[model samples]
Target: MLDKVHDLFRLRTSPVIFFVSAGLIAVFVILTLVMPEGMASFWGAGSGWIYDNLGWFYISGLTIFLIFLIIVGFGRFGRIRLGQDDEKPEHSDMSWFGMLFAAGIGTILMFWAVAEPANHFAEPPRGESTGVEARSMEAASEAMGFTLYHFGLHTWTIFALPGLAFAYFIYKRNLPPRVSSIFQPILGDRIHGPIGKSIDIFAIVGTIFGVAVSIGLGTLQIHAGLAQLFGVSDADWNFIIIIAVVTIVATISAVLGVNKGIRRLSNFNIWTAIALLIFVLATGPTVYMLRGTIEWAGVYLSMLPELAFWNDTLADTGWQNGWTIFYWAWTVAWAPFVGIFIARISRGRTIRQFVAGVLGLPTLFTIIWFGIWGSGVFDIEFNGDGGLVDSVLEDGVETALFAFLAEFPLAPVTSAVAIMLVGVFFITSMDSCSLVLDDMCNGYEGKAPLHQRAFWTVAIGTIAALLLTATGEGGLAALQEVALVFGLPFFILGYFIMYNLSRAMREDAGEVGFLRTRRWLQTLPPEEYERRMEEADASLAEAVVAPDYAEGTQPENAPELEHAEQPPVVEEYRVRTGETPIIDPANPGDTGIPPRG
Candidate 1:
């Protein structure tokens, strides 16, 4: 009985990672519960210091990641398959994109699609420099651009670089599917030592805090929906209840594993989100949204350079701290979780294909999502109906989307759908996060026990519930600060990961030469390609040695092979004869090579 209990809870691998991370999170939750104000103040101060000192680093780091991915995706190394040279992708493109969109930023988009743009429109950034005043046409245009800037390619690139590294290392090289595995090229054996353990620890901790932030946000939005729909009061107990229910659902989904649970939920999330989006476009100001979406793309492209690197050094408006830096920090914090999750599902995809799907498709979808939603809110605010912005600013940001929907027809029905969307998005994010946490804790071996996944799901929900209940009015702010603080270490870790991945790819390219014709090789008739390969092999065989040599003996002209290593001969024999040598396990001394005919 005791053994069963121990087996149920024990982490078979990387127990240190599990214990230390669990301990730290336990301590944090305890302190927050004991003194919520103190913890909140500490997080706030820590967040401020990071933003003031390292905000520029955050901005510059993400920009560099974006540029690096673009170059690698289109560069010569693009043809390198993440798995074997001939392996195909595991999931279909539709399911792949669904998981990517659902895991990466689904909840964020749902929560902020209406609120962020509304906030930006009400108060545009750099009015002194860009001359885009608040609540004007210029502000509205700038708003969508900034929205896209925050949620677009730059953000996805953060996830892409890490995902690419994980896939390349885990699938191609057969490394363990941990964040530290990406460092194997540089760390070598040290990856299994204290250094590697430390890296995984950071990943686990950061992923928890990052995921808790989203869960907390989703909880808030869920509460707001409930309050609107069923007159549920905004109480601490209700928040806990919301988190409890969602966590239970997420745990069940997680226990069902990725294909059975996460993939289906993700597909449902995308379809439902799209249905809601199309309903908004169809019901309200269709032409304006259609036109604004095109202009939004242009404005995003035009302003991307400035927004990508904007530090606000000249004026020091402190705007970036709350918006850009916060979003970037949230994204950085999410990198390991989303990166690992995407990499887990991205087996057999080429680096170029992974980059294109992970970075491009979701970005395009985000632009359309925000364009329609942002256009709706902008139209409302611009027409002298300030209720949506006022509710967001005064009432609460969580209620912004429901309030915006309230303006349209079937307010109750659309609001219910929005609530359901947030709930499912919540479940998908939590379940995926818990699964990744399980992988990180267990060193990415076979499936972890179901209880382990459930434990993580519970831990995440507990942290989010504690933050919301303890911090009271400042719960969301505290969640953001936690994301900002935990994100810094991982953000710094990303550079090392990038360096290691690039160096390894370059070394691989040198060994294999350029794989530019890898795809072209596929275009040829299989018979033709096989014939050409056979002819080339025959020529190489002649240049080396005659293929008539008996097993365990050298040909007369190859006398230099007398002192040469033995394994290369075996390899050459196999390549020439198209047969792998098999040794008898019982005999121990019998060479498995057959006598030449």
Candidate 2:
């Protein structure tokens, strides 16, 4: 009976769904373009408000800092050595780390590798835009610097922190593989049940919402590139088209299983992506690219604090809110699926090595990609008469990228290869999502049954296309809100994992007995060890509770809030009899009670 119910509820996710998705898009596009003022204006404004107003950035940054402490706490003090004997999970041939890590971050990286640099170059940042306009080297470097900040160390670091926390909890602590699982060690066993499942549902749902934006934005850009570059005309719903092809391929790959299909796909995508970056770096502009690299690096290093944790609510939040906060939330929405994906992959690795590799290595690649792609754009701006930047502005982001390369040295070949690069990225992301959404729906441990992953992948893409057509840019706007809601709690969970893990490790690493000889650890009274552990527990709590923000102290106003001190929202009201009741402004739905009505 239960199986029958599950089958009924499960989405059919067929070609008909795609056809329905397309019809919806057509209707939505007509309405959106016709009523541009209403749909576009409000969504853009609300997005801006939520973008700048929300306080999640501070919360995410704080968790990142706690992760920093955890890194130090684990290595500087060493650990109890949970002998690396835990069995690794049965997964696809693809290195768990490679497939999951690259897929979640790779597609965006591909798009940004060239597109973002160009996007920022055309309208270099005002904060960094100084001196003469077009001819200035400083202006170009400023553009590259901003993109790197968005994609580089800090942004990806946000992704990795949650991954590390989640991995440690699941693999080391033996908890279920859920976002809330990180808190179970601290919150206790109940987190594995209904309460935890609710949290997982929210995280999973929020993640898919975020991924919907990824599919829509990414699909639109890639499809538009195909249309503009090769003149693939008559493709109204190019994203849905791309989704169909990629989902089919990934589904087949998923069926052969992870090791054969997913890993191969991830590897191919990674290498092709690298080749694409190399093509840009080698063929584009060398001198400007190299020079921009130095300047952006210096600027990013100097302004790291400001860029990573700016929370001046009243200041003109141009980049901070629109770009910085938005990306943080975006990554956070991704935290549940992607973070778990990363943690699942990393095993047999040390605490320090895991943290640094996950946090630092990819960042290095992000910086370079930003340099290569962004520098290419800057070169065109300062050197090659404003052709590329101009084209990008005139022809939209997708066409602009296609047009820029067509004018380059290897025009025909590069454009064709560019298509390949786009395909790998888009498809790789599709397959990865298929795997992720599948597992998320089922238990988040093993590779989801192939048929299931394929079904949801198709469903996710279809929904995104429909929403994109109907809501247009609002779809992207709503996708961001998904992150804002989930990023903070997950960030907090990351910190708890760190704190609890620290305590667990302290006992494990012989810290409690480090002072004692081995003989003492064994011979010492159990009562003495219990008393010491209790003392450690009290100390741990105090150490972990970050102070409230004040002008003088941190946590107080730091972008990375060490701790949050928000008072509970209270609902005050009076219930009345059948008499008409006045709703209080402070508490709506409140019924005013009359003395003896």
Candidate 3:
């Protein structure tokens, strides 16, 4: 009877959901093209408001997370597994990983790079004025550092590990695959019911909305490019048509599956982005960027302690909240989608690898970015009126990038590349978010089908358009609020993971888990290091399974006897070939292998 009811519900509601999702995206493009910049700002103001209210609450929380990463990152939380069968997943090469991972960062990264430096160049943070002597360089350099500081290593860590935990726990421990699966230690078998479904569905919807608007972010850049290059009217229907065509192409690429199309596209995008960076680094006042980068590093490092922990309570306390807490909240809002997306690709990677990757790679890129572009542009600013940066602040992201580009040697060529890079970056991000949301809808975990992926990817943009219409960007703001609301509570898991990570390491290694100990895993060679991770994972999975999985907690369609017949007839799921390396039960896995097989 329940099966009949579920089938009926799925039949009736599925079509409606898909239809509504599709219809909204087409309308969103139409409306957004016609929507005034004032509306975007009105919505963006909400971003400011969040900054004003609970910004530091997030920063302090993130500060604590940094500590957790340091404590657990060594080797404790490494070696996560996902999936019931010990099947291996296909992984990208180093280049692919670099590119794909980079894609999750939204087009906002490109838009902000130009816009923010401009804003700071005019009125530096802390209300510092740039006199004729003060020069915009000082202001711009400071802005870059702060931006990098926030988005750098610290932010990605928060977004990534939760997915790692979820995927690893579900796949390896034989627990239900859902966001709540990570909480099985707390929720037990209850992780399999309505609450779990809601959590997964909510994550799906939230990510769709998030990525949808994010796709829309590229619209502005595209408009900017068109307006500047072809002298096309950004406000006209032509712009919308162009965006539709471009976005469709990107969506199609996603439909081609992760390893083939998405992977190749990301690989290209990251390489070009890096090429752009290298171009600037090599030609853009190399000496100044190097010196300024060192200073930025010092400021970043010295202030790192303060930057992570600052919760100012004094006058203009609003300033503290606006930036810090806003970032934290924004980070949380971004967490589920980014986490899930990263987690999907992160199979075969250990928790240590994930934490380090999230916390290290992005930060490295950000620092180099600030050092190169941020410092180079600021040097130009210091020498003159800093008009490039000034325009970025007064105008918008598009104009700012153009204005800054004008200062370089091959301004026109680089500008073209920058324009291309922005669009590519947006699409890469779009596909990634879409893929993550599809996983949410699959009602199973890990690699979902390409068809579901394409549907959700395009659906996300459509929904964002509609929601943006409904909330007038207030919807986007609302999404941020939702993220914060969801994220603030997840701190418990972060804490629990951190605590367990530390305890397990200490006990396993006897006295060696202590940092001062000679056998700290960090000191091991790469091969030996990995062996240790396998062992640790096997051990942890056993402990986790007895309590969490020892209970009957299979999903309705999980390939267990209960529902093994109904193997999620996915029209477009991917099976990663090499990454998921099944632990051979014949060998009973490494000493640390989980009970996934």
Candidate 1: clashing pairs of residues: none
Please, what is the TM-score per model? 0.85, 0.72, 0.73
Residues 76-178 of candidate 1 have per-residue lDDT tens digits of: 7788888767789999998998899778888889889889888888888877777878888998888888889999998898899899988877666556667
Candidate 2 lDDT by residue in tens digits, 1-597: 443444565532222222333344345345555664565555456556666556554535654664574555366543322123333344433454456545567767756666666766556555433442433565565666677777766666666666666655555544445665555435454453456556666666666666666777766666766776567664446556776676567567656655677677777766666786677777767666677676677777776666555554444536566566667666766666776666655655555656666656676767776776676776666666767776676766656556767657877677777666666655666566556555444433452344556665666666566656655566555444544555556655555656765554443233243221010001111122222233332211111111122222221221332222211110112221222123343443233322222
Note the Cα lDDT for every prediction shown: 0.77, 0.55, 0.54
Q: Write the per-residue lDDT of candidate 3 for residues 58-99, one digit (tens) a residue.
A: 666667777666556665334432332334544744643554
In model 3, what is the error at residue 160, expressed in angstroms? 2.7
- Runs of candidate 3 exceeding 4 Å displacement: 1-53, 75-93, 128-141, 174-177, 445-451, 464-597
Top TM-score hit? 1
Better of 1 and 3 by TM-score: 1
